[model samples]
Target: EAEVAQSPRYKITEKSQAVAFWCDPISGHATLYWYRQILGQGPELLVQFQDESVVDDSQLPKDRFSAERLKGVDSTLKIQPAELGDSAMYLCASSHRDRGPMNTEAFFGQGTRLTVV
Candidate 1:
């Protein structure tokens, strides 16, 4: 995955606190996604948006994790009362959805590494 733009390269927080990560996708792309990857594991989809409308968020832990792509430009992922298991790389990616499902290339960002103690 080619890296896009992400903020706060790293974060360290204690359990039960809130943490947030931001991502700016490639210009003109209409599809955005958020993923979490544990150490030594591939990224797992958490949320997906197509022009600010949520298309899929089945994998998202809605109880504590929330994602949004407002205005179809940038996106944000927030975790409230983070647990120790929440520590992982939060990746942001975008693709041209018009290319058809699973047919477009997705570019990822240098994920935010969240550490919950």
Candidate 2:
């Protein structure tokens, strides 16, 4: 079975440090998304990419966060000067929306849990 891949499942950093997370979506997926989930809140969409181009990033804080999918396959999300309030679980998901009806489901990775102190 195919699955989304994420590295460094856990991360710890002091406030004001930089941190990055990586994700590799399932092969052939055309849409990739990054989300942030606080301990008790539902996940919030941070960015969305379609074939190396950004489709939506209105919710992302551009001043401190950035994301990229260089080759339209794998992606990276980075947070500069991480803050205490930035602690959360970062999730990556992918879907082949252009495929036929049955292939509409999105697959999610295990997620990277970040702790900022």
Top-scoring candidate (lDDT): 2
Q: Give one digit per residue, the lDDT tens place, for model 1 in 13-107.
A: 99999999999999888999899999999999999999999999999999999988879989999999899999999999998877555678888
Worst 10 residues of 1 by lDDT: 97-106
Go through the candidates in order and give the clash count of each: 0, 0
Clashes of 1: 0
What TM-score would every model get versus the actual structure?
0.93, 0.95
Off by over 4 Å in 2: 99-103
Say what the RMSD of model 2 is: 1.2
Each prediction's Cα lDDT score?
A: 0.92, 0.95
Per-residue lDDT of model 2, residues 51-108, tens digit only: 8999999999999999999999999999998999999999999998676657577799
Query: Candidate 2: lDDT over CA atoms?
Result: 0.95
Model 1 RMSD to the real structure? 2.2
